[model samples]
Target chain A: MIKQERAVRTREALIRAAAESFDQDGFTVASLTRISSRAGVSSGALHFHFASKAALADAVEEAAVVVLRALTHDAGRPGSSRLQHLVDATHRLAEALRDDVVLRAGFELSGEAARVPRTDLRVSWRDRVERQARRCEENGELREDVTVGRVVSAVVAATVGFEVLGVRNRAWLAPGTIAEFWRLLLPTLASDAVVARIRPEGTLRSAG
Target chain B: MIKQERAVRTREALIRAAAESFDQDGFTVASLTRISSRAGVSSGALHFHFASKAALADAVEEAAVVVLRALTHDAGRPGSSRLQHLVDATHRLAEALRDDVVLRAGFELSGEAARVPRTDLRVSWRDRVERQARRCEENGELREDVTVGRVVSAVVAATVGFEVLGVRNRAWLAPGTIAEFWRLLLPTLASDAVVARIRPEGTLRSAG
Candidate 1:
C-alpha cells in the first residue's frame, strides 16, 4: 500500500513537471530527461511511469480534461439557466487557465502539429459550449434572431482568443476582461427576460 | 544593375522560404540550411543576404508590417467613417492572413517564446485598432454607451483568436466567418442611424 501511494504521488509530480516543460518549450523540443529532473525523479523512474514523451503528454492532457470536465459539470448544475451556466463556465475556464499550467499546456500541445493529442481540447471545448447553447435555444432563453451556431462560434473564438492572448499578457485572463465580453454579448444573445436575469460577472464572487 | 536586381530577387525568395519554414516548423526548429534549400540558394548566398536566422525573421516581420500598414491606411481612407474603416481593415486583414504566408509567419514567430521578435505583431495590431476606435469616438460614430477601450479589447481579441484558430482550420479565415462576427456585433455597437449603413460584408466584395 505504501509503495502504491508513493508511486501515485511521483506520477502526479512528473505530470506537472512535464506540463510546465511542454508549455514553455512546446511538444517538439520538450525533453523527458528535463521533465524528470524538474520533477526530481530519475530518468528510470520517469520511464517507469511514462514510456515516452508522447505518453507523458497524453497523461498531462488527460489530467487537464479531468480538471476541465469538473469545471463544466459544476457550471452545469441543475436549476440554472443554460446561458448562465455557459457564462459561469467561461469565467471559470479563464481563471483556471490563468492559474494552472496543466490546462495551458493541454491547449498548447493540442494545437501543436508535431504530436497527435489523445483528445483535441479545442474541439472538446467547442462541443461543450455548443451543447449549452443548444440547450438555451430549446429553453427559449436565446433571442429569436440568434442562432446556436453563431453563439457557439463567437464564444469559442473569444475564449480561444483569450487563451492565445493570455500567453503574452496575463491581463487577458482577468475576470473583468471576460465579464466585459459577456456584458457586450449577452444583450444581443439572450431574450429580454433572460438578459435581465443573467449576470455578466457570473454567479461566483470576483476575487479582484 | 543586373547583379543588384538578381540580389533583390534572391533576397525575396529567401524571405518567402523562411516564412514558409517558420510557419510550418516554428521558429525554434526551422533551420537556415532548410530555408536556403527551399529558396534554391547556397548557404554562402543566404549568409550574404542575412547575418542570422534572427535577421531573417526580422525581415519577414518588416514585410508583414508593410502589408499590414497598407491595409490600415487603405481602411482609414479620409472620406469614410472611422468605424467603417476599422471594419474594412479587419476584413482585408483576414483575407491577407489567408493568402499571405509572410504575414502568417510574422504572427507565429512573434508569439514564439524561444526567440525575441523585432516587432510584436499583436501589440502593433492592438494599437492600430485602438487608434481607430478612438477616432470613431471623436467622430461620434460609436454608440453612446460603448467605450473605446472595450471595443479595442474585443476587436483585438477576436481578430487574434481568428489568426490562431486559422492555423489549424482555414475555414476560420473565410470572409463569411468574419462577416458573421460583425453582423452580430455592429448593430449593438453602431448608433441606430449608422447601423443601417454599415454592411457586415465590410464594404468589400467577397471573392467567394
Candidate 2:
C-alpha cells in the first residue's frame, strides 16, 4: 500500500511538471527532460509514468476533465433553474481557470496543432454548456424569441474567448466580466418573468 | 520602375509564403527554407528581403494590419450610427479571417510566445473595438443601463473566440454565427429609441 501511494504521488508530480512545461513552452517545444527535471524524478521513473509526450498530455487532459467534472457536477442544485446553473457554472469555470494551471494547460494543448490528443477540453466544455441551455429551453426558462442555436453559439464563443484570452490576461475571466455578459443577455434571454429570478453573478452555493 | 515592381512582387510572395508556413506549422516549428522554397525564391533572395524569421513575421503582421485598417475605415457610413459601424466591422473582420491567410496568420503569431513582434493584432483589435463601443456611448446609441466596458469585453472576447475557433472550423466565423450574437445583444445594448435603427446583419456596403 505504501509503495502504491508513492507511485501515485510520483505520477502526480510528473503530470504537474508536464503541465507546467506544456503551458510555458507550448506542446511543440516542451521538453521531456525539462519536465522530469522539474518533477525531481529520474528519466526511468518519468518513462514508467508516461511513455511518450503525447501520453503525458493525455494524462494532463484527463486530470483537467476530472477537475471540470467535479465543478460542473454540483451545478444543478435544487430549486435553481438550468439557466442559473449555467450562469453559475460560467463564473465557477472562470475561477477554476484563474486558479488551476492543469486545466488551463489541458485546454491550451487541445487547441494546439502540434499533436492530436484524444480529448478535446473545449469541445467537452462546450457540450456541457449546450446541454444546460437545452434544459433551460425545455423548462420554459428561455425567452421565446431566442433560439437555442443563437444562445449556444454566443455562450460558447464568449466563454471560449474568455478562456483563450485568459491565457494572457486573467482579467478576461473575472467574475465581473462574466456577470456583465449575463446581465446583457439575461434580459433578452430569459422569459420576462424568469429574468428577475436569475442571478447573473450566480447563486450563493454555485458561485462559490 | 520595372525592377522596383518585381522586387515588390517578390516581397509579397515571401510574405504570403511565410504567413502560410506560420499558420500551418505555428511560429516555432516553421522552417525558413520551406518558406523560401514555397515563395519560389532562393535562400539568398529570402535573406536579402528579411534578416530573420522574426522580421518576416513582422512583415506579415504589418500586411495584415493594412488589410484590417482598410476593412474598418469605411465602416462608419455617413447615415449609420456608431453601433451599426461596430456591427458591420465584426462581419468584415470575420470575412477577412476566413478568406485572408495573411491576416489570420498575423493574429496567430501575435498570440505566440515563440517571438515578440512590435505589433499585437489581438491587442490592436481590442483597442479598436473599445473605441467603437465608446463611440456608441458618445452618440447615445448605447442603452443607459449598458456600460461601455461590458460591451467592449464581450465583443472583443467573442470576436477573438470566433477567430481562434475559425482556425480549425470555418463555421465559427460564419455570418450566421456573428449575426446571431448581435441579435441577442442589440435589443438590450441599444438605447430604447436607437434599437430600431441598428442593423445586426450589417449594412450592405459594409457586410461584404
Candidate 3:
C-alpha cells in the first residue's frame, strides 16, 4: 500500500473502533486503552492518530456530520421545491440512521455537543436546519404567520425529538414514520392558507 | 436529630449526590463509591439504603415519576374538564423539567430504561397521553380526521423531544417552551373543528 493509504487506513480503523466503543459505553467508560485494544493497535498508534480521547470523539463527530450533511445535501438540488426538499431530507435521514453506525454517532454525541459551543459539528446541523427554514420562507412553504425563526426552531425541535425516538425505539423508526411526522408538523407550523400544496400526495394512512 | 429526621436527611443526601454525579457524568460513571463519597457515607451505608446502582437509579426515577404523576393525577379532580386538565399537565411537565433534577435524570435515563425495561417509566407517560386523548375524544376536542393514536404518539414524542432539548440546550430551553410546544402540536394533532375548546381560555395567540 502507498504510505498515505496506510495512514488513512490506520486513522479510519481507529475512528471506527472508538466510535463503536463510545456508542456502546457512554463517554465516561470509553477509555482510550479500550478503544486502542479494540482497534488492534497499540496505545501509541491511537495517540499518534488522536492525541486525546476528546480528539478521537471530535473526529467521530466530524465523520458523523459529514454523513448527515451528505444525506441532506442532495435534497436541495435544483427543481425540487422546498417541501419536496424537506421530505427528501427526512427520508434520507431515516435511511441513513438505519444503515450507518457513523451517522448514529451524531445522535450519540448530540448530548455532549450541547455542552461545547461553536464546534463545526454543531454549526453544520444548525446550518442545515436554518437553510431549510430559509428555503421554506423563500418558497412560501411556511405560512406567513410563521416566521423563519419559529419554523426553524420547531423543525429543529422535531428533528431532535425524532432522533431520540429513533434511538429508544429503533424497531418502529422507518422512513415513512419520519416522513409522516414531518408531514403532520410542517402543515401545523405553516399558515393554514398555504398548507394544502405541501400536504404531500397522499395522507399518512396511505403512506403507511 | 430524631431517627426519622436522620433517615430523611440521609436519603436526601444520597439523591442529591447521585443527581450531581449523574448530571456531571452519566449513568454508568456515577459509581456507588463516588456517590457515597460525595454524600459522606461509607459504601456499606450506601448499600444499606439501596441494594445496587440499578436499585438506586430506580429510586431516583421513581421520585421523579412521583413529581410528574402529581401534575396529571389531580386533573380529574372536581372542577377540571379534560381540556383544562391537559393544559395543566403540559405546563406542569415543563415546570418539573426545570425545577427537578430527579425528573431530568429520569428523562436522561430513558435510553437506559429501554435497555433494562424493568421500571417501565414510559408507561405512566403513555397513560397520561392516553388520558388526554380520551378527554379530547369526549369533549369533541379532536379534529374529525385525527386519530387518538397519532395524537397520543405526537404528544409523547414532543414531551420527550423537548426534554432532550432541555438537557442538550439548557440556555435555549427557556421557560414555557415545552408548554408552547404542546400547544402548537396538540392543535395539529387534534381535530380542528373543536380544537378551540381545548385551547385554554386566553392562551392561544399568534405568537404561539
Q: For residues A60-167, could you state the per-residue lDDT of candidate 1 as single tens digits?
A: 999998888877774445667889889989999999998999998888776775566787787788888998889989888998888998888788888988888898
Docking model 2 quality class: medium
**lDDT (Cα, tens digit) per residue for candidate 2, span A120-153:** 8888888888888898998898988888888888
Q: Which stretches of candidate 3 lie over 4 Å from their true place?
A: A40-42, A74-79, A113-123, A191-196, A199-208, B31-34, B37-44, B77-81, B112-117, B120-123, B191-193, B200-208
Q: What do the candidate models score in CA lDDT, each in turn?
A: 0.86, 0.87, 0.66
Show pairs that collide, candidate 2: none
Encode model 2's per-residue lDDT on B1-208: one tens digit a residue: 9999999999999999999999888888899999999999999999999999989999999999988888777445565699988998999999999999999999988667546667788888898898888888988888888899999988988998889878878999988788889989898898667878877888755442
Writing each residue's lDDT as its tens digit, candidate 3 over B1-208 gives 6988987888878887786676666777678999999999888879888888777778777776787777677435554456556655666676677777877777676654213535445556768878777876776666666667666666666666566667756633554465455556666766554455554322323222
**Best by DockQ, which number?**
2
Model 1 pairs whose backbones collide: none
Tens-digit lDDT track of model 3 for A77-175: 675567656666656666667667766665666675223422444346657878887887787667656666655555566666566667667743575
Residue B16 lDDT in candidate 2: 100
At residue B99, candidate 1 shows an lDDT of: 92
Q: Candidate 2 vs candidate 3: which has greater TM-score?
A: 2
Candidate 1 chain A vs. true chain A: TM-score? 0.95
